[model samples]
Each structure stands twice: as C-alpha cells, then as structure tokens.
Target: MSYERHFEYPLSASSRLTGSLALGDLETGQRCYREGRLSVDGGRSLPISLTHSPATERLMYGGEVECIEHLRTSLREMGVELPGSGGRWLPGPLLLGSERTRVTQAGVLDCMRSPAFEEALANRQEGEVVVLPVLREGMKYGLQEAVCDVLGAHCDEVVVDAHHVPDESVPYLGRRMELSVFKDADLTLAQREKVKVAILGDSVASGTVIIGLIEVIKQRFPNVERIELVAPLAAVYGLARIAAFGNEAVPLRAHVFESLLNALPPEYYFSPFFPEEEMHMAKRAYSNYRDWWGVDKAGKPIAETACAGYGWSEAFFNPRKQIAMIDEQLRERHGMGLAEVLGRY
Candidate 1:
C-alpha cells in the first residue's frame, strides 16, 4: 500500500521574506520590511536580483543554505558540539531554509509564478494553513485516512480538508477568529485579572513599549501579584542579568564566561535565531550549575529565580558561547593559514 501525507503550516515570517524576494513582489517585501520580519537588509532594493531562471532560483535557495551550513560546520569544527547527535542536529536556519528550498524545488515555484497561486496566496485569510507537500514516500504498510495518523503525533489541533476528514464522529477543528483566544476560553475571575503580556516592537521602540506597559499595568491593576513579560527575539540580556543579581552586587565580568557557557544551546535567549536543541541543553546546564552552586536558605536556586519570567529559567542568555566559538574558529583557521575561509561568501 502507498500513503500520501501533506504537511501544511502557515507561512512563517521568514518564509514570507524569502517568498517575496523570489517572486519579486514589492508589496509583500515592503509589508515584511515594515513588520521587521525580513532579516537581510535589502535597503531601497530587493537584496536578490530578480531573474527568472532555474540556476538563479537554485542559487537563491542555495545561498541561504550555504551560509547556515558554513556557520554550523565552523561551529562544530571549533568543538562547539550539539547534544544528542544524529550527526549534527538541524539548526533553525538550516531546517527552515532547506524546507522552503525543497518545497520550491518540488514545483511550488511554478505554482507561485502562476496567477492562480498568487491570487490564492494573496487572498488567504489570517490563520489559514498553506499546504506544501515537497515529498512523497512509498511504503507497503497501509494506514488510516486521518491527518494525525499521517503526520504522526502533534500537540496542536489538526484540521483536514473536507476530502481528508475522517468521519462524522470526529468534529472538525473550529477556527477562533478573535485576536485573544483567552478571551473566548473559560477562565476564572482571578485568572482574568492576572497580568500576562507578550510585547512586540522594533529595537528603537521596544524599550519605550516595555516602560509604558509596566507603568500602565501598575496603574491599572494595583493588586496584581505576578507580572510576566514575554518578548520574542528581543534583547533581554540586561534584564536577565539584573534579575540574576537582584539586590546582590553583580559579580566580576569573569563570571559572565561561565554563565555564557550555560546559556549556549538556546540562542534565542541571546540572539533571535529560532531555538532548537540549544534551549533544552541550556536548561539542563543551568539546572546542574544551580545544583553545584547550591541553593539559598529559602530552598530555591539562588539567582535562578532571576530569569524566571525571562525566557531562560536561570541566567540571562548571552552570546558568550557563540562569540567564543567564532573566536576559536577564526584562531584555528588563521593558524592553519586558511584565514581566507572566513571570507568565503
């Protein structure tokens, strides 16, 4: 028997960035730019020269893969090993970029160039899942006709098209149109009153937003017990560090080196590259470090609580490990008289 599965997901911010570039769609590109989702600065022009050719298309995809592969290989060669190896674990860049490349190579590009695909894409409502099946594998074993069975276990609610719908017993996943799902969901009065925030802003405006949020929260809810601030890919190192030290005077800069090692795996703690294994590793390392350092008399890990509300649970996620790895690689490359490797575009 043969089985077919379609892995559908919303177009991520990065994917939209690449897609806009490949399609030479200025409107999409400008939207991404205004939203601060495009990482590479095109600056008054699209970074890529718009050319319609197989080679040019391949190069566009391959360029991103090459850059990520270089970083991964360089970091590995410098002895910055990832945990639980299946060779080297896939970093976010490689995973995301390669998937997009595969999808494009699988004929999504042709669809994208068509007016039908463009119209469908443009008119797609928010929260709509875009199905992009890049590969189809053959197997003798038969399977049920359900999304969960085809895709394996997933935590999020899975919905299928009418054709793929299993049976009347299993209801279709309902779409929630509200901006805040929490508002529609059942919550206790106490839970409703709690202060939880997810902040989104550009570098220049983020600090102002944070300050403004805190002031508003304090004024609005005087008795709020816990305040949680979540900022994705924002610089929280200073905030994390301050939380770590608390009332105690910050230790010497030398301590930062050790702290940096503990924070390596989850690069999101420091940089905005989507986290992979690094986060789990960082959490484990911090737990071990806390154990070794011993807890305070309150039976909690001293300084560990500082990063409680920040992404990491222990210390500020700094780029110490990344910096250290790059420095080591550069030194090794230079000593080998292969310094030119660093300039390999």
Candidate 2:
C-alpha cells in the first residue's frame, strides 16, 4: 500500500543553515558558505533551496537536448565549459539522467558552437585540492571530470566505492546510518601533502553516503582541513546532517544547485520532486498519470509520479532496471498501462 506523504521538513531555528552559494565557494575560498533565507511557519523553521539561477528555472521545464544545451552554453558564457576529447561527453547529468529521460551519449559539444580547441582552453585553476567522487553514480563522475577539466588533470582524485543503507526501523531524521561499504580508500602522500580541501561531488537525498564518506575522510586523510559538498540536488535533512559537522577546525561547506528538497516522510530518499513546470513526460509515457494522479496542494501534476530522481543516484548505472522500476510504479498505481489510460482520450 502506498503511504500518504505530506512534504514537510521542519528544522530547529537555531541550527538550520541557509543562503546563496557561488560555484567557486565549493572551495576554502568562501568562509561563509552557510548563508541563505529561511522559510518559517510559526516558531518552527523549514528547509529551502538557495535559489537564484536561471539554470534551475530551466530545469523545471524541458527535459530535452536543448535544455541541456542552454545550461551548458550559459555556463560557457560565464567561463565554464567542458568539451570531451575526441568527441566524447564525460558521463554527467546529460547521460546520467533520471527516469524521466533515458541515457544518451550525444552532448552539447556542438551546441554553443565554440571555436575549435577553445573548449580545450577551458578554465584552469591551480589548486591543491582533491575531487572525491562516490563510485557507481555515473552522473557524479561528471563532477569529478569537470574538476579535472577546469582545474587541470593534475588535480588529485580519490574514488570511494562506499555505500550507505538506511535503517527504516527508526525515525527518519534520527535513523542510525549503517555503513554497508567502507574500504581502505586513500590518497598518496604526494596527493595529500598540500591538499587541504576536499571537494565531494554527488547528489544527496538522505545524506547517508556523505556521512559515511566523511567518516572515511577523517579516518584516512587527517591532513585535510576543509570539506566542501557539491551536490546539485539535495534534501534538507541531508544538508542539515552534514552541517552539524561543520566547525572552525575542519569547516564543512555545501553547494546545491538551486534549491533544497523535502526529504519526504519515513523513507526520505525519493524526495527530489519534479516541479510541475519542469517535468516533460511524453503523451505516450505519462499523460494519463496527469489525470489519475491529479494535482497536489502545490498544484503539482501527479505528485507521486513527479519525482525526477525516481531511481536514486544510479539511474544510468543500470538503465534496464531503471526503466523497469518506472513501468512497475506506473502499473501499480493507475492499475493499467498507458495505452488503457490513453484509450479514454
């Protein structure tokens, strides 16, 4: 049975963090990474996204090649472009899409129409930092690629094949995080010598994986002084969980795309809700769900089916299973296939 869920993430006023974050703030440069506006109801505080970008607004609409192009082109104009060598796109959000869109190799390498070898001369930052990407999610691998693309390949990198499974038996916020995977991941002495900052790039929902990675970093890299979280989409619960670890000694900072998401209820991992304006389901795919699922109090079309992050962080890792999961949910909810739902029309 589908459990009733009301989207609400209430955090205590004193400890809740908020504010705008720049892309460069993902390093130790910005001291005040924890700053943003808060949404309050009565005496309790609510989780909110640090929004102020046209890219985030763009995401709420079309989920096509053009949408990706516009974002990349805009970023290039802002001096951040990534053109894969030999006509290849490093696996990022484009290829590692959600259940809404399947994976594809075709990229925006030709979109903005940059001069030949121009993208090769992309932004290069001389930094003593390591970009640590959690393995399995090909989407986040893009972040790892991006750091090297912009900061030069000489930037240190450590891939941690760690995993975190939530214990559903306890409260969602206070649930005991069980580390299912923690190997002896490390950086060489040369990689760690001057590397004081660690930039971790990944999509955070419940923030369990990050919590585990932090433990690994503390245990392995004691020389590291600062931690920066670069998650494009994250839940409020996850950010708050990581925020608790921030301090003057080893300050922790976070950088989200445009907004913070509600961690839902019970199991908070499936809360990267797709905005009604952003979701672009084909008529053959989910037009019926628009009617059956209807709208939510927020006017969201089919609140249940609108979550863009349906298959967690690895939608592209196992495409077959991702597609199957989407079909299964649609069938289980509407009690029929899209054809039957379309027959009425």
Candidate 3:
C-alpha cells in the first residue's frame, strides 16, 4: 500500500474472505470497526471550501478512530493473515492508500498532485486502473483531478452520474435509493480490453449510487479483477450494501479501507450521532448538538449528526435548494427553524 501509514481494522470482513464461506449480508459491518463504542467524536470545524466540510475531517483523520477497541485481549485476538498479504488489510488485494493527513480541499488536491500520489497510482502494477469517480460529487475534493494529475494523458477516466436521494420506502435515515440503475455515464470504459482494476473515490454515505454504478461498470466493462473504493468517509451501512452486492451477484473482489464506521443515524444518514468518548475532537460542534438538539432522552445526541456535512450535493444541487431541503428536514424532525439550527452552529 502507498499510504504513508494506515490505521488497523481488525474486524473488517475482508479479513474473513479466505475460506469461501460466502459471507452473506453483513449487517452494514457497523460494529466491526470499533472495539466497542457505538458512537464517535466529531463536529463544528466549519466548512473550509465548497468541496468539503470540516465535519468530514473529524471522522477521517481528525478524530481518534476508537471503535476498534474490542479484540484479541487474548492470543486469539491476532486474526487471520492471508498467505502473502502486503497491505494493512489481510486480504490479498492491497488497501486503498491516501496520505490521510489533515483534511482540506487544498490538501486533497495538493496530495493528489504530489509526486508521491502520482507514484501510487502508477504503481497499481497489477493492470490498468481505471478511475471511475461517480459524477458530480466524484468531481469534488480533487478526486477527479487526482486521476488527471496522476495519469495525465494516460488518465483513463469514467465519470458516472448516479445519485441517491430519499427512497419511497422510507425517507428516514435514507432508505435504499436503489443504485442498481444509472442515469448517465461519460467516458465510460465500455467493452474494452480487460481492465483489471477500477477505483471509486467519494464520500460514501448511502451506497445507492455506488452499487448502481458498479452494476453498470460490470455490465459494460465486464471481467475486471477487482473494484477498489477510495472513500474518504464511508458509512459502514453503505459499505455493507457493497458487500451484499459482491456476495450475491457477480462475486467481485472489492477492497474498502475505512478507519471507522459507527452506526449511521437515519436522521442525517451520516450524523448527529455522537460518541461520548469523542468530546476531545470537534468539541464546538459536539456542544452545538448537545445544546440544540437536547439529544435523545438518553442524553445522547443524534449519532453522526454533529457535522454530517452540509451542501453535500453542491455539484448537482444549488445552495439555495440545499438549504431548503435542510430546512424541511429540520422542521420535520426537530420542529426547529433552519435559521435557528444553522445559527446555533
């Protein structure tokens, strides 16, 4: 792995794929990342750029990834090690790498443009690594640019337009927006020579769009060796969807390397959920949630809500519309005004 360093995920399901057990429908793989804590520390950094929110950093490298607390209190704690695995993940495929330093729009772009990152992409040595960033959002945080900067003329890019919104089944916590469909695809790698690897980089919340895009990719660009998700802050629930897809359908070899995947609160899908253990990080935002939401009766703030991120659909949705949507959600759930809520933050 080209990552300068990688945090360990002892409970990742990828660690259990060796025996052909057909690991069916892993329940979003939520509890696996953390050792025991169900919530995480995060909130109130403020948005630094149109592309990302400081709320995001709290989950990535900003906060301590402590959910991985349980385990091998005994010699049995040392999980299986694949025969020749080289990456942090014990599975044969290497973990997706990122410098994972302080999160910033500039830093994201700069890192991708760095010589080290370029070398990382080049070293995918197994075969051609097609960069398939989901449309609109994929273009953010320098994800799409990374492909261009790294590969330049050799950049084989596929921009996919697959978005996930509230589904009819339940607008609560984001129901499955069935990503098994696609609206559009640009520069798609259709029916080409066997491209063994594909990289998907995004903030994976609801895995709807990804599963849909992957379906399209496998259909159009069939017979690939592996699909790697380069998600910055992926939800365990979302990753679970991908796992389910791989387990049931085409049997794809996907590698996801997220340091944490606490329970995804249905409210914001990503946040308002707070881990009491995380008071040390994003203390301001944490306080904001506790003070404003008044938290649940248990005194727990909505998990993942502190700073689940704002203007997430900036690529496709305008700010005005985005705020309006937030306003509606705020009123429906909290019975609070948008200005009242936003102002508190």
Output the number of the lDDT-best candidate: 2
Per-residue lDDT of model 3, residues 1-345, tens digit only = 111111211223243211111111111211111111111112111000011233233323233222112111211122211222122211000101121222323334433443334434655542366766665555554554555555653545666656667555532223443443243244344423456566665666656666666666677656655565555444444454455432233333222222323433333254323244232123344454345444433444433343343444441234344445554555555565444532432
lDDT tens digits, residue span 143-252, model 1: 11111232232212111111111233321211111111111134334433442211111111012223333333343333333222212122323223222222221111
Better of 1 and 2 by TM-score: 2
Better of 1 and 3 by TM-score: 3
Candidate 1 error regions (>4 Å): 1-88, 95-208, 230-345
Q: Once model 3 is optimally superposed onto the true structure by TM-score, how far is the C-alpha of residue 336 displaced, in angstroms?
A: 2.0
Task: Report the number of the highest-TM-score candidate.
Answer: 2
Question: What is the C-alpha lDDT profile of model 2 across 50-104, one tens digit per residue?
Answer: 3222233223222334334543443344334534323321112232344222221
- Using lDDT as the measure, what is the rank order of every candidate, best first? 2, 3, 1
lDDT value, candidate 3, whole model: 0.39
The weakest ten consecutive residues by lDDT in model 2 span 104-113
RMSD of 1: 24.3
Report lDDT (Cα) of residue 233, candidate 2: 60
| Per-residue lDDT value at 205 in model 2 | 73
Q: Residue 106 of candidate 3: its Cα lDDT? A: 36
Per-residue lDDT, model 1, residue 28, is 26
